[model samples]
Target: MSVDGGHRRITNRLFYWMAGGCGFATGVVGAAFHLAVDRLLQWPHWLADRLGTGPLTIAAGAGVAALAITLAYLLTRYIAPETAGSGVPEVEGAMEGVREVRWRRVLPVKFVGGVLSLSAGLVGGREGPTIHIGASIGAALAEWLRLDKLDFHALLAAGAAAGLASAFNAPLAAVLFVIEETRRQFRYTFRSYVAVIVASAASAFGMELVGGTAPQFRIDTDALPLVMLPLFMVLGAALGVLGLAFNKTLLMALDWRAKAFARVPILYAVIVGAAIGALAFVMPMSVSGGERLIAEMPVADLPLKMLALIAVVRFVGTMASYPVGVPAGIFSPMLTLATTVGLIFGLLVEMALERSSFPVPPLTGAAFAVAAMGGLFSSTIRAPLVGVVLAVELTGAFELILPLMVTCVTAHVVAQVLGGRPIYEVLFERSERLAGRMPSVRSAVTSSPVGIDDPPRSETR
Candidate 1:
């Protein structure tokens, strides 16, 4: 027994070391992916500028986007269908011992496919793919290290936390996200909790070293009047409705694609990619994951009509691109859509204030943008703590925590009352029903005996 204990201790140490390494690597790879995509997207702009012929440049740009998206979908369809959509569900399911983690397939396909899909001006975020990538790394290393099934799940969560931290430089929020958002799958043990913290810290540090430390969004407003709490709640309720609409629309789109277009995903991809490509050519801000759009919101100060138009385009783009089954995330896109709604709401409030005699601090666009982001995310994702923490952390606006909590929780409750299930839960259900019927569709989960207190599975061990 003494000898066995000694070996167990040494094995645990090695697992920790490997898990830490995976976290560091997640940061590095995530940063590199960001840089690479930025540079890759720049080439089209560079070519267009040099070409000096708008038609020629536009055609060239569209062609490249079409080709890149075509290749990305092909890779996903033929190689690994698991690399589709927001991968948070995939990681969550893996933790529950439901789906297989083929890092060998996931790592390369996600890297290459994510680059192509994102660079092609799709409405998606890189962080979701990065999470999948990070979990794959941990799973691969755990297999190489011969860790038990229990440790495998722990390290996987640790890696996912690291990936999210690397993406937004929000280590604490990332940890909370793993613990809160994936609470059903993730069982917190002392070793697992420590691993998650260590990994998140390492990922944040390493990513900052590579990508520089900058808040994802800069907000000038520090606080809101207490009188605005009711308004914030109203905003949350609006966002809750928006969230329900967004989820219903996206799922409907997915169903339409599955029923009507699954037979020819490639052709469908080309048509969708070309439309997005054309939009990219005409209005670059209307396409892609929407970081640029978010950054421009405060400075551009566009009119309500223009903002509404842009918001509609963005919403359509998100709905169209997401259901096509490529490697991408809806988080950033959803945030973009929600921010637009907030802007519209703020504009209406500002108009109301202008007409009224009440004197209060005028709400800034930045404030509404940030608040609505969390509110809609809370409603759709059904992870209010993650949404609040993420907003506070990413914006570095701890002052808004009170308003955020109010907004996020309000939205969450409204969505619950409206009977709109979380988007991921809906996706998981779709996956199960479609798995056998559709060759391209795959389930994120299956019934597994592995639970929080389950002993190590003999097969996995």
Candidate 2:
């Protein structure tokens, strides 16, 4: 018994070492993916600056976008279909034993395809591909290390945390994301939990070393007064409605594409890519993930009509782009949409109070922008804590934590009360049906009402 205990101790230590190594690899890959996408995205902007936004520049942009997106689509459809879309659902499916992570194919395909598609100014985020990359690294390591089934599963979860940590440089939020988002699939042994923490820390350390430890975006704002709590709650409720609509529309679009582009899907890619690429040349801020837009957009200075127009365009852009079967994520796009909507609300409130005795702060729009980031995320993802942590971490707005909490909880409650399913679960179901592992009892792209506390109804898992 003593010998057995000693062997177990050694095995545990080795498991931790493997987890750390896996996390470090994920961090390294994620950093490379981020840097590559950023650098590649600069080429178009540089060209457009020199050539001006004329018909030629627009045509060039369309051609470049078309080529990039077409290549990305081919890679996913022919080489690795699992590399398509936000890989979060695929990772979730893997955790539930419903899918396999083909790391060998996924690693290269997701990296190249993601960089190409994202650089082409597609409306998506990096977090999804990064998370998927992290999980693939974990799977690769697990196989190479000959880990047991349980250890392999734990390592996959750890890699997931590492991925998110690397993406936003938010280690705490990454940990919460694994805990809240994958609670149903993750095995919760004490050692497994510790492994997740270690992986997240290691990945964050690596990412910070390469990309600095600053927040992803900064917002200059003062704390909200107690009198504004009710207003934030109202914003949360409104975001909940938006979240439901976004989910429904996104799914419906995917469903439409599955039937409409069944035979010649590449044609669909060309059309979307060309149109968005041209739009990038015409209205550069309207395409791509909304990270730069969130960081640099002058929300306070923009008119209400402009903000409303921007919001609509982004909403439609995200809906259209995700269905193209490319490597993309909705997180950044969703945050951008939420920020625009929030700023719009703030502007309205400011206008209302401008005539009253109550004076509005100049940065009120920014504060609401911060809160709405969390609110919309909570409503759609159904992970209030993850959304709150992500908002605070990404924006460095600690003073607005109370408002963030109020909005996130209100949004989550509203989404739940309205029976809107979590977006990832909805995506996972769609993936399962597409793979022919699950029966299509309902419409391919429509969302069904799911209870807040319900477990995923995947029988194959």
- Alpha-carbon shift of residue 167 in model 1 (angstroms): 1.8
- Which stretches of model 1 miss by more than 4 angstroms? 1-14, 212-215, 360-363, 437-461
lDDT agreement of model 1 with the native = 0.80
The top-ranked prediction according to TM-score is: 2
In angstroms, give how far residue 4 of model 2 lies from its true place: 13
Q: What are the per-residue Cα lDDT tens digits for candidate 2 across 1-461?
A: 11332222227777788888878888888888888888888867787898887899889889989999999999999999998999889898887777899999999998899999998999998887888999999999877766666677788999989988888888899888888788667776777887888898889777766873322577777887789889999999999999999899999999999899999989999999999889987787789898877866644488899899999999999999999988888999999999998899999889989999997876899989999999999999999998899999988899999999999999998998887888998999878877787823432221112212643456437
lDDT of 2 at 358: 93
Q: Residue-wise lDDT of candidate 1 within 235-307, one digit each (tens)?
A: 9999888899999999999988877876776887888777777677688778888876665685677899988
- Cα miss at 215, model 2 (Å)? 8.2
Query: lDDT, candidate 2, residue 265?
Result: 87
TM-score of 2: 0.92
Model 1 per-residue lDDT at 410: 94
The estimated TM-scores of all candidates read: 0.91, 0.92
Collision pairs in model 1:
none
Q: Which pairs, if any, clash in model 2? A: none
